[model samples]
Target: MIPARSGNIISTGSVCSYIGGGETHAYTCSKHAIVGLTKYAAVELGQFRIRVNCLSPYLLATPLANNFARLDHDGLENLANLNSNLKHVTLKAEDVANAALYLESDEGRHVSGHNLLIDGGFSIVYPSTCFSTQNKIENE
Candidate 1:
């Protein structure tokens, strides 16, 4: 890509990259590393017109996620939706792909070293605590 003078390097990350999600220490560390790499590489490679970015998505009901969460597809989806700040919207692989497409396309030419979060605002909002408190209030 250095020779080409234009390139886009996109890496996969997780919400764990920005916040703890009860994931394994190694997994969280690796995700964090990906963000660091994206930032550093973007700085170093920008002169060559190479863009480096990351896509951090929340939990999806993939086989690996299902196995890790020990839940079936529907169960995992339910759990994710229940905890998501954006209710009624289930994340899909295609959503991540679309983000990748955007980053790679000319539309994102000016975007570099960006960690595009596809987490449905899950990383920004503490749904677990907020929802629990809401439930308590409703019950009361």
Candidate 2:
């Protein structure tokens, strides 16, 4: 189990965008590494039928962090905004557990080395509706 983790290590180490203190890419990079690790491990473990994968999840509704439950609505929303594009991508433990169940079952029998991003829509972003406007602004 490549433990789904935060990008603290990579974010703190060396990403061109992280000049000052960028926790965003840090955790992003961490999860990215998990994907790479899962792939490499799965390739080696294919002979053994030992599947390897990652369960990359965003901010979940758990008591892992200190004073998280105490946060107000906006604060919570702000946290959800980080790393994910989903407005209110709140994840419950059951959601993750259900995914795990599917992965472990025969449904995922052949699936391996997947960086299953359980983030509501955080990892996947579509083209912006105001792309031209933003491009004009940048050019100006």
Query: What's the TM-score of every candidate structure?
Result: 0.88, 0.58
Model 2 regions more than 4 Å off: 1-26, 66-89, 126-140
Please write out the lDDT profile of model 2 over residues 1-140, one tens digit for every residue: 23442111111111211121223445546645666667887787666666776676555544442253356655554665554566655666687778777777878878777766666664355223211333555677
Best by TM-score: 1
What alpha-carbon RMSD in Å does predicted model 1 have with respect to the real structure? Answer: 5.4
* lDDT for each residue of candidate 1 in 1-140, tens digit (9 for 90 to 100): 99999999999998878876436678878999999999999999999999999999888889998986678999988988877889999999999999999999989999999999998888778634322333555678
Q: Show the lowest summed lDDT stretch of 10 residues, model 1.
A: 127-136
The local distance difference test score of each candidate is: 0.86, 0.52
Report the number of clashing residue pairs per model: 0, 3
Task: Tell me model 2's lDDT, rounded to 2 decimals.
Answer: 0.52
